[model samples]
Each structure stands twice: as C-alpha cells, then as structure tokens.
Target chain A: MEFGPHLLLATLEGLVQASVLTLTALGLSLVFGVMRVVNVAHGEFYMLGAVLAWFVTSMIGGSAAIGFMAALIIAPLLVGLLAALADWLVLRRIDYDPERTIVATIGLLYIIQQVTLMTYGPDAHPVAPPFNTRLALPWFEFTDGGLSMYWPWGLSTTSYKLFVIAAAIVTLLALWMLMAKSKLGLILRATQLDGETAQAFGIPVEKVYALVFGMGAALAALGAVLVVPIQQAHYLMGDDPLLLSFIVVIIGGLGSLRGTVVAAILIGMSDGIISVFFTPTLAKILATLLVAMVLVYRPNGLFGAKPA
Target chain B: MKSKTLLSAAPTRRNVLTGLAAAGAATALPNFARYAHAGSDAPIKIGFQVHRTGIGAAYGRWYERTTNAAAKVINDAGGINGRPIGIVAEDDGTDPKRGAEVLEKFANQHGCDIAYGTLFSHVVIGSAPRAAELKLPYFVVSEGHHVASGMLNRYTLQPGITDVKSQVQAMAPFVADNLGKKVTMIYPDFAFGHNHRDFFSEAIAAQGGEVIAKLAIPPTETSFTKYFPQIPRETEVIYHVMVGPSVLTFVKELGEFFGPSHPEIFGFIDSLEAVDFASPGLEFLEGTHFWEGMPRYAQSNQTDADKFYRAAIGIDDKGASLDDPKDVSTYAHMFGCWETLYTIKDGMEASGYKGPADRQSLIEAVEAITDMPEGREHPQGAKLFNGKTHQVFGPQYISKVEGGKLVVQHTTSIEDGLYPDEVDYTAQSF
Candidate 1:
C-alpha cells in the first residue's frame, strides 16, 4: 500500500525476471562465444524444457516436490542432448558457417515448434511449484518512540519465487566455476581463443564445440524448468524469451558471459519495474531504444573483446 | 481408439434414429424427396476454411474433428439432397492474408458449393469480403460480432453460435450480481479481447457496476505477474479472458500473485478450454466461475441430445476421449462447427439446392430458419436464428469449478442474450 512496500514488490518481481533472463542469455552467450554458432532456436529449447517439465511431472505422478525436483534435473539434460543431436545432424553438415547456421537454426526453430505442437497439442499446461508459502514482508515506520515494523498488506511474495532467485544464483556460480576451473573449461577457452591451434594440439575442437552448444541449450532448459511452474508451457511460448534473450545478449556483448549476465539483470529489472509502474508496452519500447543506443555507441557491446 | 471403435461398432439403426431424433426438429425436416434426384450420384463439396496452424490451431483441431463427425453422420443417413456431402478443407494458417487466400482457393480452385468452418474472429473478418466478392456462401462458426453487426455481406452468416457481444451481455449481469460491482479486466490485446473489454464494460455498467482497471497484455506475453501489479488494489472481481498458447501461465501467475486472498475471479472458459482443471497449481480456481459457450463437463441435467452428440463425436462426459483423457476436446466452441454443418444441411435441403447455381436459394433457405430446437442437429443447445441479422442466439452457461470439475451453475435463456437487430442481412441485396 505504501511506497516502500510497492517498490519492494516491484524489486522482487524484477529479481524473478532477472533470474530467468540471466540463465537464458547465458545460454545464448555461451553458444555464440565458444562455438561461434548463432542458435536461433535457443528459445525453442527453452520451451522444450518447459514442455518436458510438464511431461516429466505428469509421468512421475506425485507431490509437486518430487515432480519439480525430477524436472529440474531431467529437463535440462534432455534439452542439452537434443541440442547436441541437432548440432551433429544439421550444424555439422553445414560446417557451422555464421550465415548458414542462422538460417539452419531458424529452420530448426520452426521444426521444433511444429513437432512440439503436434505432440504436445496447443494447450498451455501449468507445472506446480514445489513450495509456495506466502510470507508477508514487514515494512518499518518511524514513530515517536522508535521505528516499528508493521506487516504491509499486499506486499507478500511466495517462497517459490524466492527459491527461483536462489536457484539461478547457484546455477550461475556453478557455470562460472565450470568455465573457469575445469579441464573442459581450459579446452573450451583454448578453442574460443584459436580453434585451428587447439585442433592442431589435439584438443578435439569439434567435440568442445558440440559440448558448448549442448551446455548453452542446457542452461536455457534449466531456466525454463525453473520458470515453468510460474508460467505455462505452450508451443508459441518460445518467441518472447527468444527476443528478450537476443536483446540482453546483444546489449551485454555477444559471446560475453559476464556482459550477458549484467545486461539480463539490467533489462529484466527495468522491464519488471517499469511494467509495474507504467505499462508493459512502454517497457518494451524503452528496451528496444536502449538496444539501438548500445549498437550506436558500442558496436561490439559492453564486454566484447576489441576486434583484431 | 477404444471409444471410436465402441461407437462405430454400436447398432447402426439405433445411432441413425437417435441422431435424427437428437436433431430436435421443431421445424419440419426438409422434404428431400424432390431434391434427391437433383444430384443423386454427385458429391456436394463444402469448403472448410480451417485455422490448422496458428494461435487458433487448438480450436481448429476440434473443429475439424467435429466437422468430420457431422459429415459422417449426414452421409450415413442419406446425405443432403440424397448426394453424399464432402468436406474440402483448406488450412488458413490463422493469418488474415492467408485467410483471404484460402477463401479464393475455396471458390476458384476447389469449386466448393459453400465455404464453412472458420472459428477465429480475425480470420472470419479478413476472409468475409473475399467470400462476398467470390459470391460464395460463407458459413462461419466464429463468435465475433462482425457478422451480426453487418460489417460482412449477405454471403457470410454466423447461424450456428452467438457472438461475443451477445455472450458478454448475457454474462455481465450474473458476474455483477453474484460476484462484485468493481471489476478489473485482464484480456489479450486484440479484436477479440477488445470485444470483451468494450461489451463487458457496457454490460456491467448497465447493471450498475463499474470496471475499475483494464489491463491489456500482449497476446504473446509468457509471464503475467508484471501485469497483475497494474490492477488497482481496490478492484473487486478480476475478469480475465486470455487466449493464445500461454493461458495456463496467465492463470497460474494470477494465483501465485494473490494466493488464496485475491479478488473473486470470473473468466471466459477460453482461458482453460483445452486445459485440465485437475492439473497442478489450478486448485486456486476450484471456486471461480467461467463463462462457457457450451458447458464442457457434462451436468447431471444434461439432455439426452447432448449425450447422444458426445457419443457421436467420441468425446467422454469429461469432454475428453474415453480412449485418452489427455486428448481433451475444445468442448465449448467445436459444437458450432457441428451445428453449422447441420444448418447447412437443413438450408440446402430447404432450398432444393442442386449445385452452385442455387447459392442464392441456399442463403434464403438459411435465412428462413427461425428456430433450432434441442436435438441431434442442434446439440449445443436450442438457438433462435435471427434471419434478419444472420446470427444465432443461444443459451450461455456459467459454470463453477467444483472438486476440479466444471459444474454448470446457471443457464441463461436464449432471450437473455438477444439484442435489437443490428442490421438486416436480408435487406442487403445479393
């Protein structure tokens, strides 16, 4: 009801948005950065994650906790495997040329979307949250004696939403560790630096490319599985996430994971807050304008390495 | 598969007689004896302009199934005018340009005697002009107010189902009286949603209620919690009518945003048409009410006619297949396609239609249809065909979710949904 509570509610919403956006853009950034492949079907992978979540939950047939936990683990693995298969079958055949890959992934987008439609049917199905306990946030008011905490009406949020934020942080940290600390990370970084040199050194550069591609898609699926409880899974749900991820990735700098995370937060927070305070249409217009300004001022993006 | 086999294996004489009986013929059945000789061996081609691959694809699937089932019944019992009825289906892709293109294909290429089975309002609005220009009798099952409002020509008729204007008008009073006076509407930002936004406001206003906040979300929006914050805190009833592929999200998000302590909710069943009520996270909707064109879950008082039709189409009492519960049918809107085909049959027989030359006679014959009683042919419910406006007026059901099943709580009479004639289609020259 008061300014502080409303702002807090808005911030909470923004945090949820930022969390999902980070995972989605991370996937897009990883693919482009490591594999040099622009996967236009990244959003479809996100949708597939949600659909697969629904399928897994339905098949498991138990309480929300069990189903959700299964989905969190299984959906991403399945999506990553599917993405790797797609790369092996289609992208490898075309040799992963930038222009051809874009067109091919677009085709993949439609193929995945249509297949999901045919199999899943065009109905939106909801996945229940494992837990959704509402905890009313207390707002402090300065009185004559001292500051007193009062529970603000309509300022409460579900525990499940908070869990989503927490889960995303853990996932992002784990991803960073994998990229920075592991042997696979060294090979991937080497390939990203110079694919021909890495290949000459017997790093199995092609295998790294496939792994990166799968990892990227798996991150998207992870995001989708987390958010699917809050959102329904449908065939056409991929388009918006796709557009938003592209916007975040471009602003963050293509292939720049750090930049991608930063841009996703910026865009997601602004989107949530502005859509609440003003209108959803205005938020979208402002985001698009920000993209244009970023392109004009910094062509390579905020975290992008300078071109050779 | 089991349901289909069981239905097919049932006694043919019983099915045919029950079907004829279910087609509540308050008006006399057409004397097809004379017209039977006109095309004894020919097949009468009816073009089905279906939305097989877009936002309306879910509805399109059920619409196609209903159309096929109806055609099968018609052919089983001596087809229209003794000639076997054939459906020539063209997928409009649910795009406006594609809709017009499909209409042209139907008239110029397919040589269909009539164009039928369009459900999406936008597609119907887009393709109507082309149908008029081509002089093809277009029978739309869409619920948009365009046809009754005289925006379309005489060739385009919506004689099977009521439009949004009439539906909202009937539903508003029940929503206002039983629910709350201060309503907040959350709808998809499109012509169909606009119809709800406008008509519901007007209807509620007439009942001394006011719509406090109106939130129009992009149809493609996946998440909806951001939009929920826009609804003013003072809002009483939340009126939602969301469409597209992400309706489950729209509903689940609302529940999450206001767990157990939100405003009373009234939604168009379009939001959950193909969705299972027992699905996880939908328990919040247990007591909420939805406006249905036709009651999805069969009520205890369901007529024998409705039961017979459900069996005829292989749908269970739950509005899904007895064979597979997950393959749920769009129970509300698909009935329009089945009933529309029957109207076409009755109109053709009444007009003694021989071929395309008798198109005008066919239009006049349909306009002559004043009443459709509750029977096999009019299984959705009894409807009054306004020969003047070329739209049907039918009963609208308001159902409440109880124990994860939709229980019909109120049934508004056909007269409750009627308005003064918007335009006289018969006055408009062919």
Candidate 2:
C-alpha cells in the first residue's frame, strides 16, 4: 500500500522519537565504548529517569507546562547523580567479567524497576504534551522536513514536535562539543583511547570513567523526559526503547556515537512503519531478523569501523 | 513475609474504633477485619491468590480494595455462619506460573477453606487443575469459560457466563431483531478473537443470516485506517474483535470513515471499561450496541444482593452516589470473592463438623452445591452450578453507550449452554 498522510505523520513522529533513542543510545554506546561493560541494564537507568521525572514533576509542576520543562531539565541531572551513586555502590566493586557484569546489570534492572513500581504504584502517569494542537500536514514546510498539514495554510511545524526535534539536535550538538571541545571531553577521549596510557599520564582515569558514566546517565534521563509527552511514563516503557538502543549500538558498532545516531533513525522508521502495518509482536520479529541479517552480512554496521 | 495473613489486610484504624453499624443484616454475616472468629468460634479462612503487582496491577489494585471492602460489609452484616471470615491474601502478580505458586501456598501453607479470586483468564485456567488437585473451591469473576465446565474435578466454578458464545448471544439476537444483518468480522488474529469469529458467525447464521466477510488483524494492531477498505462495503455491520488501546485506536479510525450511513459495530463491554469512550469523542459509538451480562449495580441490579454492592462500593466523599458501573463492576467482580467465602461456609455447614476446613471436602461441597448460597434467587439470574460441568452460567445483558456512559438497560433471558462439558471451548476455532 502507498504511504499516506498518516504514514508521513508516523514517520515524523518516529524521527522525533528517534532523537530520544539516539540520545540514550549515545550514552549506552559510550559505556560499552569505554568500559566494555555490556550494560544490559542501561534501559533501567532510562526507566529510573522516567520514574524520577514522574515523581518530581508530580511534586514540582502545579500545571502541565511547568511540569514538562521541569521534568526535561531536572530528570536527567537527578538521574545522572543517581547513576553515579549506583556505580559507587555496585559497579565500582563489580567483577571484571563481561558476561557477569551484564548479568549483574540485568539483575539491577529488575530490582530498580520493581522498586520504582513499589513506590509509584503501577498506574501509568500521564504527562501532557506541551503543544495543544496538531499542526496539519498540508501547511508550511518545516526545516526539520516535517510538513505541518495539521497547521493552517501556513506554519513551519507543529510547535511541540519542532521543539522536540530542536532539543534532539541541541542534545547531539552539545554532546559533540562536550566530547570534542571541552577539557572533560579530552580526558574521556584519552581514557577511551588508552586507559593505561591516560592513567600513566596522571589523568585520574577513574574519575574520568565515573564522570563519563554519569553523563551517560544524564542522557538516559534526558531521553525519558522527552519521551514522557508521547508514551506517558510507565515502568516497562523503557524496555522497548532499551532493546532498540542496543540494536542501534550494535549496528553502529559498539561504542560509536555517530554510528548510533545513523542507526537510530533507520531503525525507528522501520519499527514505526512496520508496527503500523503489523502488531508489535510481528514488528519485533522483523526487527530481530533485520538485526540478525546486519550482523551476518555487514558484520559491522554501514558506518561502523572494523573491530580490533 | 510480605504481610503474613495476606488473605485480608490488618483492618484500618477507622474500622477498628467504630464498629460496623449493621443495618438489618442477618445472623450469618461476613467478618471483615475485626473479630475473625465471631461466627462459629472456628476461623473460616478464605485464601485469595490475587495480583498485587505486575501487568494486572491496574485491575488488581482496585480488585483488592473493593473485595476487601465487600468482605468488610459482609462482616458488618454478620460473620458467615457465625464464623468471621479470615482472609489470607497472596499476590500472584498476574503470572500463570506465579498464580500456581500462590495457589499452592494458599492451599497448603495458609490452609485456606477456599481459594477465592483471580482476575486473568490465563491465571484462572492455570490454577483450575491445582484447585481440583488440592480440591480448593476456586471462585472466578472472569469472562473465560474453560476455567469451569470441562471435566471439572468439582473445584473451579466461574460466576460469570462464557465470553465467546455469551458475547455472540448478546449481539446476534440484537442484530437479527434490530438491523436484520450479518456483520463483517475484523478480529485480532488470536485464540480469543478467533473464538468470537467462529461463534458469532454461527450465531448470526442460526438467525437467517450468512456471514459476509471476515478479516483477521494482528493482536495489537493500533492503526486500522488502511485496512478499513479491506472489508467490502457490502457488509452491514463491522464487528471489532480487539481490546485495550487497539480498540481505542480502531474506533477512532472507524469514526473517521463516516460510511455505511451509521455502520453497526459490536464488541464486548470489557472493551468499554478499558477505554475512555466519552472523550476522544466516541459520538461514533453513539447508538452502538455491545454485550454486557453484568448490569450496573444500582440502576439495573436493585435486589437485596445489590444493597451490599451499593453500601460496599460507591463511597464518593464528594457526596455523589456512585453510579459508574465501571467502578461498581470492579466492586461486584471482587464481591464475588466475598460471597464465595460465605459459600464455602455453607459447604462447611453442610459437610458437618469441620476441623480446619480441608481442601478436598470444600471443593466437593462446591461441586455438590445445587445453587451457590449467595447466587441469584431470580428465575432468570446467574446460576452458579447447573450440575453438568460444575460451572456457572448467567443471563447475558446488552449494554448501549448513551451520552458518554455504557448503561446496561436490556438483558437476555436464560439459555441452555453446557459449554465446558458439551463443547470443548479450547478446541474451538482459536
């Protein structure tokens, strides 16, 4: 069937949604990139961010507008601190075994999710969208490539979606600048490139590693804050996105930030479209097959560098 | 030990200080939180293998609240057979494996007179054999029929009628009487939806109608816009066989169609409960009909039994009498657990002197019951056991969505349907 306006709308939604995915995947890729810790529990961090965002917003935001911004800003930072704490308490003394670490994180994931559930209770907390209306697809063209016909005869984009896309772009750009342009960025790269060498240079590589993990935690929270408007904050909501991020990281080549971004948009679009056609179960089957094919055929993803 | 003696909670401080002001309740009353052994001085412990956490948590939270409240009301009236109902609640978390675990714990560890309640059909089905195995009287408030009927070891009994045939019974008669049309079925491709498709077609055909078209969609298909045209325009009714967010999405898309010049749509009333049919503006569902065997508490069900329902539920401090059937249905469904405890008490009374209320004897008493002690006294009401499959069947009611609420206005008379025994519900087109 030919892709209709709904399809276009779905794709636009997917892209903005992909921004959140890429943001989280970037953090996941960073963790895997440096420590070689599989971080199977990366999604739990995202869930923690969402849960924190939900509770804090419930306390802070008297209204939807205030809640939206407060959650977006504070959720990630708060989660970052929490992530650092988790590292201190658990991961700091964890076994160096990769599979064991993965298994431990998985355990941590369930424990964290269950604890959140026990606290917040299991009902889905609704986070209202910042924008009031859909900017129709047949209106003015957006710089972000979404045609807002839900708008009047002319409007660049639906303000809400445009804000999300802008946020995503700003997040990616800020991450790039932080990694490439800042002193912390330099330390991170140095540690990632050669941990023992960086330590020999008296760089305090342990501090760098901890900080990098915290930043990863912040990104996961940021992703949750952005996602609240679309899906509403739920405990299990992070699982799907978490699995997708794993796919993106693996597809982009583990530890590759740019690779994750490219892979996210493609994966998001495929998932969004296929899910519209089939049930989520079927879409998952297709996604699994796609990931398997990529692993077999490409070995590394399209933009991924060959493994050592 | 997540609160040992989980059958019921430690009574709230409010209930403890201010004893229930019993209003014309009989000697055989229910003992809620206070005075567990008031009835026979021998504690009648009823076990509840319920969902406290997990996916079913949404329903489970309300279920526990209402059931516990009902037990409180029953206690206020009088303890069952002069024995206060001691409840041991266990959290199954809506998992079948977990349900079995809790059922085992409930029967063996807690030594319950009967296992009272479960929400999910899968949980009910999984726990039925165990109920028969340990011979614990398992009372269910689910839509599935397989939990009862089929070669029952006289332990499990559903208070509600079968879902598939009952769903068809509610709609097909309405279709034949009102519209004189057979509907095109667009169901989710699953055992649940397929059961509806197979039965509804036969039900519709039995009424001088032929099935026009049938299309199966994915189980969780949210978008149904493109697939709208897949059902030929020739069909009169577009019966949606889906639930949850999928139903909401499907209806929203169907609202966009504005075709068949008032296309008749049909489905289960359970779908109505999950959805906010009022907003997202389902004026599209206006004048639409669906099957609802369980009537609203106060509006339709105004019998002596309903007094307990009204008192137990509808406690809005805003001073509005709770008429919302959704809330009351949740209350009543859980109330079945309350009544089920009393039924076990009746069985114990019939079985003569009980030591600790053995599981095998309790199940035997439940199976041997000609009618549930608390079952409908009306000729055309829900029958607890019909001696055929040791299951329950009730009159089905048709609900119409009017002015943002699904109110059960009309009800179907009695029908002879020995589902679990005469028909293998599982073997049907799933």
Candidate 3:
C-alpha cells in the first residue's frame, strides 16, 4: 500500500481505538473528579459489562440484532448496580479514603475476576455484532491526467466498528449533558467541591458519592459493551483497557473530562501512526516514553489545576 | 547389702512388665512390616503444574480435563505397576516465577514421583531448571523447541508433542507448493513466534520460496487492522500464527481488512484453538488453511485411536465438550496432556518405578523410548520419540475451513517433522 492509503487506514483504526479509550478514560476521570477516589477495579467493571453482554445475548438468543440490542441496555445497567453495591458494602466503610479505597478496589478487582472465571470459564467468548459489513475505503491520488480515487487493498473498516465509534460519541455526549446541564449534576458537583458543606446543606453526600461511583463504572461498561463485538470478552481483557485508561487519565490532567478525551485521541492516534513508521513493540515503548516525559515536565498534568 | 534388698523388693513387678513389653514388640513387628508393604501400594503421585489462573487458563482447563481423563483410563486398566495414578495438580498462574514455585511445591511439598503437564514455553523454561536441580523428571506438553534446542536440562523432556521448530519446518513444503511461494509472515513478537519465523523462513527457502515481509505484532495488541497495511502488495500468501485471548479479534480484523479479496492465508490453529469457527467475523475464514497439531474436527479418515481419545476426553466430533457444544476444547494442543500421561504410564511401567527413589530410572526408561505406535495409549498418531533430544516427532495435520468446519487437507508423515538433534539429554547426568 502507498503511504497515503496506509496513513489513512491507520488514522481510521486509531479513531476507533480513541472512541473506546475516550469513554473508558472519561469514567476514570469522572470518579476521580467527583469522589476523589481512584477505583482500581474500574476495568473489571468494563470486563463485567462485556461478560454480561455475552450472557445476556446468549440467554436471549433470537436474531443477532435483538440479542445485541438487549445486551446494550442490560449489561451496563447490571454492571452499574454491581459497582454501586461494591461502593455501599466496601467503599462506604472506608469513608472513601484515597489509599484505602485503592486497596479495596484492587481486592474488588480480584474478586470480580475470580468470580467471572468460575462462572464464565477461561475462554474468550465473542458476542455477535447486531450488524457487520465491510466498507472498502477509497484513497485519492494525483495522476498525469487528473486527480483520481481508487479503492486500496486492505483499506477497509467494518460497519460494526463505525457503530462502536458513533455509539461511544453519543454516550459521551449524554454523559457531558448529565454533568453540565442537570440538577443531579449540580448536586454531584457541589458535593465534589465541598463534601462537608454539601452535607451541611442537606445534599445527601454519601448517596451522591455512591451514585457518582456507579455512574463512572456505568460509563466504562457502556464502552465495553460497544467494543465486545469487535474484541471477545475474556477475563484478562480488562488489563489493557485499565492501563490505557490510566495513561489517558494521567496525561489528560487527572480529572478533566475535556483533557481526557483530547489525550485519548492523542495517545490512540499516535499508537497507530507510530506503528506505521516503526515496529509495534517500538511504538509501544515510544508511547510509554512520551507518557514519562509528560509526567516529568507537568506534575499537575496537562490540564490539572495548580495547587491552591 | 542395700542393692540386694532393692532387687528383691522390685524383681517380681519388673519381670512381669518386661515380659509384657517383649510380647507387644513381637506382635507389633509383623504389623509394622505389613504396614510398610501397604505403603508401597499407594498411588503414584504425578504433580501436574497447571496454568489454572492466568493467560494460559483456557488451554489449562482442557489440559486438566484431558489429564484427568487419561489418568482415569490408566487406573481403570490397573495403573502403572499396580498402583493407582494420583494427579497432584497445582496452579502455576501461567507466570514463570509462579511456575518455578509450583515445581518446588511438587518436588518437596506434594512428594510427587514425577512432575508433568506444563504448557507455555516461558513457564516450562522457567521451571525446568528447578526440576533439574531437584532431580525431578519434568515431562512438559509444551510444544516449544526449548527442550530440543538444548536450552532446558536433561530432566525436562517433551515426549508428548512435536516442538515448534519441527512443526514449522513440516508446514513449509505444503505452504510453498500449495498455498503460495511469496509469503508474508505475521506472528507474535516472542520466543515462540521467533521460532516460527526463523525455522519456517529457512524451510521455505529450501523449497525455493521466500518470505516477502515479516510483521511481528506485539503480544499486547488487541486490534490488528493497522498492521495489515504493512503486508507487501506482492505477497502471495499471508502466514499468521497468534496466541492469547485477543487471537479471535486478530483473525476477525484480518478478515474485515481484506473483505472479499486477499492472498491465500495459512495459519497455526493456535490462533483459533478454543474459539468456535461459527464466530461472526470468522465467516471470512471459510477457505483459509491452518496447521493443526491434531485435527480439531474429526475427519472422515479419522483413526480409531482418535475416536477413543476424543471419547475419553468427553469431546464431541466437532471437538467441543460433550456437555456444551459451544465450549470448544483446545483439540490441537490438549491431546498432548492425554498422550503425555500415557507416556508417563508407559515409562513408569517399563522402569518398574516403585517410589521417588526410582525417579532417575523412570527418566532413563522414557529416554530409551522411541517409535510409539498409534493405539489406545498413543492416540493422536504414531510418534517417533527422539530420546537424545527429549522431543517427539509426529505427523502434522493441515486442514482447510469448509462450511464452518476444519477439513483435513494434508497430513505430513512423521519423517517430514524430523529435525537434527540439538542436545543429547540422555548423555547428561541425572
């Protein structure tokens, strides 16, 4: 393939990856923003979503479309409820203490992983996409006669991949609206700003914290449900998303949603683009190196607020 | 005068006590010998180092099932040396560090006569040194060339399955002549993948074919479409072999990237071992060929031994679990566990293995084994065990996907997979 088509394909692949990363990072950022708690089990919740999707789809077998549609709604909702339960049972007792919460969530991670292993077994199960069709992409080239467009070999994306990208965008948009325009958003924000003050003002602070944690996990679950059609749901699948989400959240400025989305795009696109120029392993090393450089220069992160 | 008085006073009571004690010792002596004799009849403990928790868990699940099934069969037929086969399994977590620890637990803690059943080359490599140090006969089902490459010690033997070097070399003739001459190789960037890359490259060149490009995907990669662009346009065939949870995604993305038009595709069944062929995006793989260690789907010409083996493991003709059709077994690889367990039985019987003290003789017995014929014992196929290199040579199966089923296209003879010995493990000291 020519350089133009190759870059074009890489960008498209990067965009799909960025779409999922944006949703996952947004969840991690939201939790840290609202509750100041780093939920180490966040990725397990994502894995739970994918696993539940498989369960739901398999149980409600009919047409692939019907099963998928059902999974889209049920998986995330179930994952959200589970996360809320974990918050109530464990995180609530810890009083959302930062260090203790991290440890608690790590414990929660192992519990969820082991339970899933016992129930779902140790195989990677694929969920059928509602619909999938290969769409061959055409690349533009300048010729002696005139500008021409031709379909390049291996330059294509699936319909399901495009759906994942679009679904993530709509979900992220709804999340933005929930945060920026709702009364619940206002209550959550007030609690985030000053928990004691919000409690004094009768904001039900604990309830708000539980809700925020659940919402954060629900967002990640949503991302996972969309990607499950492309990537099979395995217990260990959560590890990569968790690591990538952390890198995105850290590079984007701890709790800044806009920064998280931007950083996701930057990291995700670079992952694809760099692989085009170098080996995939070298590309991963370079990306990790970039994160290190950013950490050294900007301790507060790209969009993180300076210390008061 | 004082001693005489004390002796007279206690002599009656002491004589009675001494007579009772002597009678008790004489009675207990016969019983002690009988108990010692019964101890020798205890089950021969084979410590199974399993990957029950980590990345290899999928393979581990089937490996365990096959091991148990093989053990049951051996025991039912009056086990090795009249002692029942006792499998003492411990999870290695698929990590090399944990693997070594598991081996120690097997040697000292479990008091296993021999340690067996470790897959994943890294885990096998990590734990083999400890097996040598402990003088444990470590029989690995892992098809890694590490054993044959002389990287592991004499105690580590691979008598169940053919190694990657031999398997890869065997595929070259069929791939070059039938599939295509100009190949584009895509494999995981690890030792296992490097084995495929190096061995197949050499083997293909010998057949007057050349590899046009080699795209080594990082093991951590989930999506693979972007890498598809790097495949040279002039490539006649794409040879891919991937392992891990994301393999289905890799194959699916490869299908979506090419859509309708693409070069001939040849791959190792490791990419789709536990995965179902009826998966959504895998429809594009309808005509691609795969190198299977053993045919996943039962063939029309399937041997009676294969039928028996499949029945023993509770796998259906399609290679899925008998209880659940959707849960596919790692048919191509899990056969190693079955065949290896039987090989252990054969070795133990031949060595007249009685206890851990006979472990060296057991290893020696296995090292002398060669030319295993297909039967109820060696089920997958006839194998030629290279006692010197501590690896097995067997026929390699190449199957093509037809109507969402793998149909065997070619079966290479045992000689096709024979390679020169890299190490004389038999010469090494126990």
Best model per TM-score: 3
Candidate 1 lands at a TM-score of: 0.90
Task: Indicate the worst ten consecutive residues by lDDT in candidate 3 chain B.
Answer: B29-38
The local distance difference test score of each candidate is 0.88, 0.64, 0.88
Instruction: Please report, as a residue range, the 10-residue window in candidate 1 chain B with the lowest summed lDDT.
Output: B27-36
Task: State which docking tier applies to candidate 3.
Answer: medium
Model 1 C-alpha lDDT per residue in residues A28-103, reported as the tens digit of each score: 9999998887899999999999999999998998798999999999999999999999888888889999999999
- By DockQ, the better pick of 1 and 2 is 1
Q: How do the residues B312-345 of candidate 2 rate in per-residue lDDT, one tens digit apiece?
A: 6553321123665223233323444545445555
| Each model's DockQ score | 0.40, 0.15, 0.56
Fnat for each predicted structure, in order: 0.54, 0.12, 0.88
Per TM-score, what order, best first? 3, 1, 2
